[model samples]
Target: MGKRHSELLILKEIAELLNTGTNMDEMLSGVLKKLLQVTELDTGWIFLMDGDGSFQLAARENLPPALCYQNLEPMCKGECWCTDRYNNGRLEKATNIIECKRIEEAIEYNWGETNGLTHHATVPLRAGEEKFGILNVGSPKKTFFHEDELALLESIAFQIGTALKRIKLIQKEKELALTAERNRLARDLHDSVNQILFSLSLTARGGREMTENEEVKETFAFLQDLAQEALNEMRALIWQLRPQGLENGVVSALCSYGQMLGLNLQTEVKGLLTLPGRVEETVWRIGQEALANCKKHSQQSDAMIQFMIESNFLNMLIKDSGCGFIYDQNQELPSLGLKSMKERTESINGDFTLISHPGLGTSIKVRIPI
Candidate 1:
């Protein structure tokens, strides 16, 4: 095949891979592998800028032994030459080939094999003016990329960028749909269940006042209390279906929820609490579940919540002084509420831990990296 025809064939294959209906991570990894195959490159990687303005190494293929042996922490920290330039806005074109400082340093210190790579070329993975990331490819002997190869790389990067944008749009649409459904449910509960609970409370109070028998009066008073508690629970459910105080922050929302549950909630916040919307939402949901668990399982009427924010992470603790259950590592968790809490925490790449004993109180701790 002619050189041009060969490049076209490779591009066509990559285009097919991108359209394979896989998730974004799998698709990008497949694209990187395909790129390395077509170009006979030793290694390739992609760095994607996340919504929080942090660049992360999203995918990689064919790492050299030396690079693989080294700790990944440095590479992921955006310390490499290509990523540094990209962050500094110096890498603005498909043809920008830069020497690999890490490779040079490795050679200088006789640390590890460079896999014959002295330099690598970076192409801006962008759609028009909006740049998403950098696509890097390298070979042992090639110090610079040819114009045709640069063009091909640019084309592949553009395709990846377009795919990423499409995925984001689809995710956003799903989130909006979910929010709409939640709002509908909230409204329905308010109009139906809430009204019924309020009417029941009123009727119970009237019945108690009209009854003169001491035993009957006591029964009516108990009924009235049950109705009132149910009303509070229904209100809390409505608030959760559509968070009202979330605009103020997760702290405020949780406090409002605790009030409805009639639980004595003590909250402590340390450091700046500003977070991304998704992060805040995740925290709020987990908080709701934890509090719900406390109300249902804990025999105590008080709980404590703590929020601590650091430079790179945010931590949360929910504790309840209630009758805790025995925990078995080999057995499935007994509470679906705790299981749901774990799932939600993991979805955001956060850490979750549950501590409980037969007599000791249960505590939930979460740490989410921002």
Candidate 2:
């Protein structure tokens, strides 16, 4: 094929390999196979630097999949011959494996060898100017990769590095979302079950004391009422924990949160409130957790919550006149409720801050993309 035509064919193959809709390992294997075909290398290997900066053999030509999964720490950082080439930023090439000091050392260590490789070139995989790993190509003959061939190999490395960065970013996003979900569930469990347990303990103690005096009898009855309120709160917590958010819509969920608060909660959703799935879930969880915190921690008998949707964004404000705790007090105990709310806010790429003072009032403001 002509040079331009060959380049275009390689690009086409890269695109198709990326769109294979397979798992990451399978995808990497397929991409490496395609690279070998396009470059006609005797043997090729892909090394990846994991999140912790440790190198691992991600893919290899003719290597068993199980062996390819082995980790290779202290890669070029060690006292190997390849280490010298990598540290000096020089691509090593040799006609004889024995003449290549690095290959000989690596072979002696049983790490890798040039038994089937004569001419070799190592391409560094870089993402945005940061080198993440090396793409080493070997040939059975000498000087297999010329300047043009090396350029093509470097381009492949760039493509692989870009894809790896994208995949890592996507996985990180999913992890953040999962972490937020776990925090929300944990807070719900604490607020509901723990509160009920406290209520039960109070009820039992009050009942025991009521047997001695009629005045204590009235207190026991009050405890019964409080227990019932705890039950209602538990139900609300369960509803919020449901994976599905506002099946009817954001408006419906906002209204539900309002009704659960037992106050005048008005939701004026202007523009479209249809946020991204993760964002929607995050906002709903934040709202639910905030309202529950208001009821549990606020001394206010009446609170107000408003949800407003505008161009490309959603805004929420919840205010209550209650015994507010100091938000910035380092000596104060950290509440799981506050931590969970903050995490949820971060997960949605939103901002959440509580304005409050002891015996004054509390106001929570949240702004997120719609």
Report lDDT (Cα) of residue 367, candidate 1.
97
In candidate 1, which residue pairs get closer than 3 Å at backbone N, Cα or C atoms, i.e. clash? 116-140
How far in Å is the alpha carbon of 214 misplaced in model 1? 7.4
Q: Could you estimate the TM-score for every candidate?
A: 0.85, 0.48
Q: For candidate 1, lDDT tens digit of each residue in 1-370?
A: 6876886787788998776534888888988988887887878888897545578778888766555545654346536767666777877787646687766666665666667877788888887777888898998888889898898788889989888877877888888899899999999999998999899889888998998998988888898899988998788778888987888999999998887777899999999999887889899999999998898889998999999988678999999989998987677767788889889999999998998987788999999988
For 1-370, candidate 2 gives per-residue lDDT tens digits of 5966885887788867665434567767777887877876657676665333335566777532222223533232334344344456553321122234444445565665345544456777767765556676666655555677777777777777777767767777987787679668857786768677677857766695759777777777677677777766666655666533377776677667667667556445556556666676777777777778777778665777777776456888878888987767344326787778878887766887778888988888888754
Count clashing residue pairs in model 2.
1
Q: Number of the top candidate by lDDT? A: 1
Q: What's model 1's overall lDDT?
A: 0.83
| Backbone collisions counted per model | 1, 1
Ten-residue segment with the worst summed lDDT in candidate 2? Answer: 91-100
lDDT (CA) per prediction: 0.83, 0.65
